[model samples]
Target chain A: MRKKGSYRIKDIAIMSGVSTGTVDRIIHNRGKVSEEARIKVEEVLKKVDYRPNIVASALASKKTYKFVMLIPAFSKGDYWEIVNQGIERAEEELSGYHIEIERVFFDQYDKDSFDKQMEILEGMEFHGIVIATLFKDSVLRFTTRLDKMQIPYVLIDAFIENTHCLAYYGTNSFNSGYIAAKLMYQQIGPDDKLAVFRFIRKGDSCSTQVLKREEGFRTYLDENHFRGTIYPVHIHADDNEGNRNILDSFFLLHGDVKAGIIFNSRVHVLGDYFKARKKKDFKLIGYDILDENVAYLNNGLVTHLIAQRPEVQGVNCVRDLFRHLILKEKVKKMNFMPIDILIKENISYYNNYI
Target chain B: MRKKGSYRIKDIAIMSGVSTGTVDRIIHNRGKVSEEARIKVEEVLKKVDYRPNIVASALASKKTYKFVMLIPAFSKGDYWEIVNQGIERAEEELSGYHIEIERVFFDQYDKDSFDKQMEILEGMEFHGIVIATLFKDSVLRFTTRLDKMQIPYVLIDAFIENTHCLAYYGTNSFNSGYIAAKLMYQQIGPDDKLAVFRFIRKGDSCSTQVLKREEGFRTYLDENHFRGTIYPVHIHADDNEGNRNILDSFFLLHGDVKAGIIFNSRVHVLGDYFKARKKKDFKLIGYDILDENVAYLNNGLVTHLIAQRPEVQGVNCVRDLFRHLILKEKVKKMNFMPIDILIKENISYYNNYI
Candidate 1:
């Protein structure tokens, strides 16, 4: 049974003594009808309030929206995959619209993989692009193409400088680092060293994002009159055996460095080192809520995980693109995810959700 | 400009060499069409892919959804107001649908005010409801009518027991309190006293949510085999001068109770007390991100604010109501919110746009 004050089209048609089609036509303003039928429909409509459809009208206009997300290729349940899950959620939301979203993969560490994806995308046509902006030089080339093509794009994971992107949706790397430093500094002494882990892939240049985080982390420590040394430790991103050699030697060489912070989502790499050694004591601050990071967090090896809302970024990239391109709405240029400080007590509420 | 590999109904009609009306009829299966025209539309349709619209089809079916959110009349920038903002956001998103949500407010402190609202609601009908089940007897009486009317309703803020409510959309109160205790337990010793603040309103009995929180807080301390005294301190929800007298005496009497935790959103009451006193040091853990609470948090009085995403609760309560009632979608009965631990460093990302 319908609630009071709610009327169906069939009910309105019955009240107006006409077919639902006549009522629908009068309501949508699409077709001609007899003046008598129109008046009858209008009389019923006057008592009712109905809003015209949103994206249905967009579909009616017959414009197809193609949005592509250029991101790193990763295994299931990794950082990028979680971001993809959010994009998939948004894709499900806009499934009815004449809109299509394609995810293009690149090797995060390999410039060649990135360049391959860019070359493949060279012949592609899209209404908008959502690029992860990982590799700066290669992205400069691709985004320049976007600028030349005049296709509005959003930058995710990093905020690239001097770009004409429609928006940037990611963490403020500096603030995130400052916050992570705040957490780490609370537990450490003025003389205790903090190891900043930078997991390296082949031929990978340090991103401006990572460097900004390092700068912010150092700035916080330096401003606090930290007498301890803050040193960088670069480890292989994929090579587990080689990583063991690097980390085992580093920890053995600098036993004073108990407090550590990884600037990337691969903080689990350090966790893996500890996991293999069967020791779960580390004041480590890492990034992302990946299952690996969380498992280490529960095991008490990782103290705090500063999270950027990748899922939110994924969802907003698609939505904001639609708003700007299809709905012609003005969009914000930068949208930073919140710096979430997750401890063992508070991490359950924050499982890949905004 | 349109993206590649997408088509509109007009384009499909053009592809089929038929009028848009014939194409629309075949796409929507609305009207009787010539078999030849249908065949032509089918040929064009086979080359394209489209998922039918979600809510627009509900509109096409012509059902009006009337939802009512019966909540406490709160001041601007308060908890309920933030929830209203989330609800308003959802309302804007659903502006194209045939649904109208009405918010009815009542005096939170007055049982008569609640009864008066119940009386007003008695004459009205709703397709579904989102009620802030505060007063137990009053909600029990009101929900009995809902059961009689066969109208589904969702619970917000506090999950009342033994109610036929469709779902709950708020923090798991017990877990929230347990987490708060963990934070407070970090600073206090077994010999130290912990004050559990219960801000009392007129004609108010302790809510089940608050009691569960109290139970959880004590259980955590007890589970740890603590010898600390955990006691309740009842103060007025309103009477400021009386509250000042009560608190001044309580502090004078028990100087050992430096650590405090307020279970409900009205923790700002204690913050206001501290603000007036210009006291910047209190190991106080409160709930919600009220401006008063956040200001005190910055000033170093309130240490942590456990934020239940009232805004997210507001957004979901409406959307879930629509999903269950209008869209006929299966909805889970218990939708607990993430218990967000808001500190001075992590508070920036939480400006209520979740």
Candidate 2:
């Protein structure tokens, strides 16, 4: 009955002496069909062994899909804005397909805000959801609810383990850290002391992303048998005085530190501190293409940037959701972004792509 | 008249007391309409500010578009095969949009083969063409013919200047070279002699892409005031005995050369040569993610590979052609690819994206 896979719905219809619409309705179990037509279509279907393509059938159907994107609120920092722009581009490209995107923004610094938004989303109905944030506990609880509701979700930017996500689209944080260490290794000697800066808000634990990066950095140093002492400094990001105090104490304690690697995007804070003191000898490597970081990179104060393209992450989040929900396409579990090594000369091209 | 951006074909059809199909036909200048319907649509077109989106209209129309893709023939070297995979992906995505892609292959090292393919293409009619090759003279003549024929074309993999191409999708060879130099700079000193290796066929001149990369590499060295003498070595790619002889001579003359940069993807040849001799002191930088090169990178023989994603380039070549020909979207002149710096730790993620 399966034959050579050359039989289509039209062929079935022709064989059944029925219209294609009638055959489609019979196959989909939608729309009323005459008994005679239904029986004829069923007979042809059974004889021809037609297996419908779920993706193609879904596309052929006139069904509207709604996708909700949960992300951090826009701020003066252009990172999330660029990400939103990527989502908008996907929305525009998918407009003709009867797909709608609803954006829900939560305060990046507030776990309660995320919980409140998820509560509101629990009351609504959407085919799929895309989430991008670092609120681990809240996301874990919400994903439990999503699991109970059988709603598929995708994670962007930061991935959490032990969760049932449709897909994860982001950078491999540990690998990025390992590569950052390699870049720093090129400039430093075996015995040269290096500083690891982790900037965090007061009372906030370092993000899993940042922690993985630090682990990767340390692992690289260990595996390569580097004799350098790694001085770890935690700066309270919310208080300038506290940050200054931490930096001052770190410098006084580790005056021999020749290079620094920031585990997060706030490398500019250290760059500014170094610049103000006219410290030209210390080399730094950090993450992201935030304006301050790029400025520091151009100033030669920040040597290299490990760019995990946030825009690409956002775009793929929406695209993967579309594929999973509307097209019924199989999505890869992990969509790791390229770890882009950005310098002054190549930033323009990278910017254009993003 | 232009009150707001709210005019649509349905609105015109409503006001003009015509069916939407009639309005569409009148707007697109397709499918004959009654004289009365035509007059009404024309009057509405004159009165209200209605600008038909050329792209949407083209998509809505029943016209089928044909695109020709000219690329190097695939061999055991999977570079062009990956590119063809990208093109095939695009074709599959655009299959429902009435777009047909005709792929024509040319021998990589033969100008006559390219010329023959171009002559055949000139005789046929295609809406657009995407070409990837560095046969400069043949391309210039073919592009002139394309210009006279009013066919828009795109260049991928290698870009030529002062052509009437719709867009160029590939790495900026010079910037890639400069960045490669930067990567090398991190591992070399002021007086350390470096060698530049260009591997080409016996009779073929150095490709424009390779030459530009060499220029960029030299420019970086000059701009930074490097005092090292650059030894340039050209090996006939097809002659193994000749390549070994040349490498032996190069080593004998420049035994102090501690670093080398390959201007093309054939860096694996040199890597193998060096590895067979148990030479581990030379830090090498090369281009592309060809299998042998990645193996060398994993084996720690190749320090870095500058990946100008051929797959991404091929994908964009088709997409940009679609935008220009069918969508009537504004395509940027130069679509420079990001110079992806690949090390062992991050190459897996980059490979996944590719």
Candidate 3:
């Protein structure tokens, strides 16, 4: 019949027949307190499940801290823009706690932009940072410096191994890829030909998510012993002539492919290519829900989409990072974002804010 | 570069060139402030977007509230049990704010049990209640009394219309059904035979979600001009002989049925029947993710599931009701939950808490 509640320090003091100072000292493990008084205070605390109110504590200590977000420079209506909106939401929610968040973006297609941003971050004074690990080598080096400075950091979008990350908030790339294959189980048979299409710009950026997703997809097919020929094609992004040459070669060679998967957020590029040719009956699956992808999905150009909840991921990364910085709370290290399977039928019901 | 935040009352008063008491009175719409003072305060409030801090105000009031959850009696591993867990989560989150939740259950299959529970509820002194609107007539009548009593209530699982409820938290049943039919578009063609299955016990409980889902499902097929015949069947629940007879007749008549839909959480029962028969090529879509249903899903009996986020609905229902009651805030009437599409591959990614 009792509620899951905590008693106030005053209540604990009265119950333990001790002064509030002794209880406070015991609770904080600071100053000094007698062993008998500590045991009595500990007993009362245990009995009442004495969890201090986070909101009150946050307001009581008016110490201000700064956190920075290291992400890709994005235009409006892009995936990074959506992530920025979510970060803004978290910033608003934590405004009363005096936690300031500064967003710093680097060009995802250029390693020089990453180095430039990292140089700026090196001189900035911040308590914590959230990174979208686009450039693996640059980010790892920066994280090493962060570890030396004792600054906690969170990784989003993708992660690096052997780095001291406070937590990682993103989709499990391998599982998402495996699930993409699973979605095609009812449609594509064993003898059907499958393709993996990836669009990339020239850069030394980390390809962890891309490689992991495709690996998972192939692993599923291999594990199921799918009796089909699989094809993988890489197209140059944002280079019209280069992409055209690459894609023309792919279509001429693998036009008979029954199904395909795009490992990145630009499934729309494939949709655009197919739209011009009026392609039909070719099942296409990909990642994220850009508006172009939704239009393609509705028109049946794209069969299904696996959304990584970019906004949701951004909100959690900042919120949990703040919890650790301000309240000294322990956060789970690997907080995987949900992999939402979206079709034209169920897309309206998928909530990114959840 | 400014954050989305509000200004303090002191700052507002100083800006308006008035006393803090005058600003407070103007803000509260009380104590007959002068026209000039009111104008100044109003202008400053609008300019500064003076939203009062919910947490600070909540702590200052130090008032307590009692919210009652009137739901179906739940076993340890049932759908209702999952909803209960969500309610407990919300209850614990609000514990620091002095809000207490009391759970009251009623038999879902018996009208008399509902009546008795309603009588007990009517006699209790509660700030608010969250109801699982199972029985339409009885619930509507009770809502009328609640309106007169000026006590707010929220409807979960399903809702009854024409009532002054504070809010309704559940999936939009029609959209869920329409989406269910959409899931079958790739598998079941226009010429495939489909069946709608229902299990019921003798009672006057309202079947809003069931009827709406079926209606939506049919609407999709009808809109598409499906050439297949859809057979609807009802089996008596908890009556072994009656269910056996009904199912036997159904199997004798429609042994070649290619697809089926269950409008409730008992898809596992159908899975159980098909298990022994080793039925293949029959696509069965149903609701919820009970352990039994998940087992069948993993074994390939249940093809896909559309989940209503039952626990998420419960948590929101209670939390929003508390906000409306204690914070003097306005709440939206209809909060439709996301309709998550689940398969064996992506089931682990579904988060009820979010």
Candidate 1: fnat, from 0 to 1?
0.34
CA shift at A283, candidate 2, in angstroms? Answer: 1.2
lDDT tens string, model 1, B248-336?
Answer: 88888887787899887777788888778776656899888878788877777888888877888888889888888877788888877
Measured over the true interface residues after superposition, the C-alpha RMSD of each candidate is 4.8, 5.0, 2.5
For candidate 1, the docking band is acceptable
Collision pairs in model 3:
none
**Each model's DockQ?**
0.26, 0.46, 0.51
Question: What does candidate 1 score on TM?
Answer: 0.82
Give candidates' CA RMSD values in order: 6.3, 4.7, 4.1
Q: Lowest summed lDDT over 10 consecutive residues: which window, candidate 2 chain B?
A: B1-10
Q: Model 2 has how many clashing residue pairs?
A: 0
Compose the digit string of candidate 3's lDDT tens values, residues B1-354: 234454667878999999999988887677988899899889988887787677667855767788999988976667888788789878887766778788988877776787789999988999999998878888898899999999999998776789999999888888899989988766787898988988775674536778889889999989988889889888766575676677778888988888899988888878877776677768999899787877877777888888878878878888888889887789988888778888877777677527
Clashes of each: 1, 0, 0
Instruction: Give one digit per residue, the lDDT tens place, for model 1 in A102-219.
Output: 8899878777888898999999988899998878887888889889999998999878888899999988888788888877887888988878888776765776678788888888
lDDT of 2 by residue, B56-158 (tens): 4564578888999998887777678878878987876676466888999987767778888988886798899998856877788889988888999999877
Order of all candidates by TM-score, from best down to worst?
3, 2, 1
What ranges in model 2 sit over 4 Å off?
Answer: A1-18, A29-66, A96-102, A110-127, A238-255, A351-354, B1-65, B97-100, B119-122, B252-254, B351-354
Q: Is the docking of candidate 2 incorrect, acceptable, medium or high quality?
A: acceptable
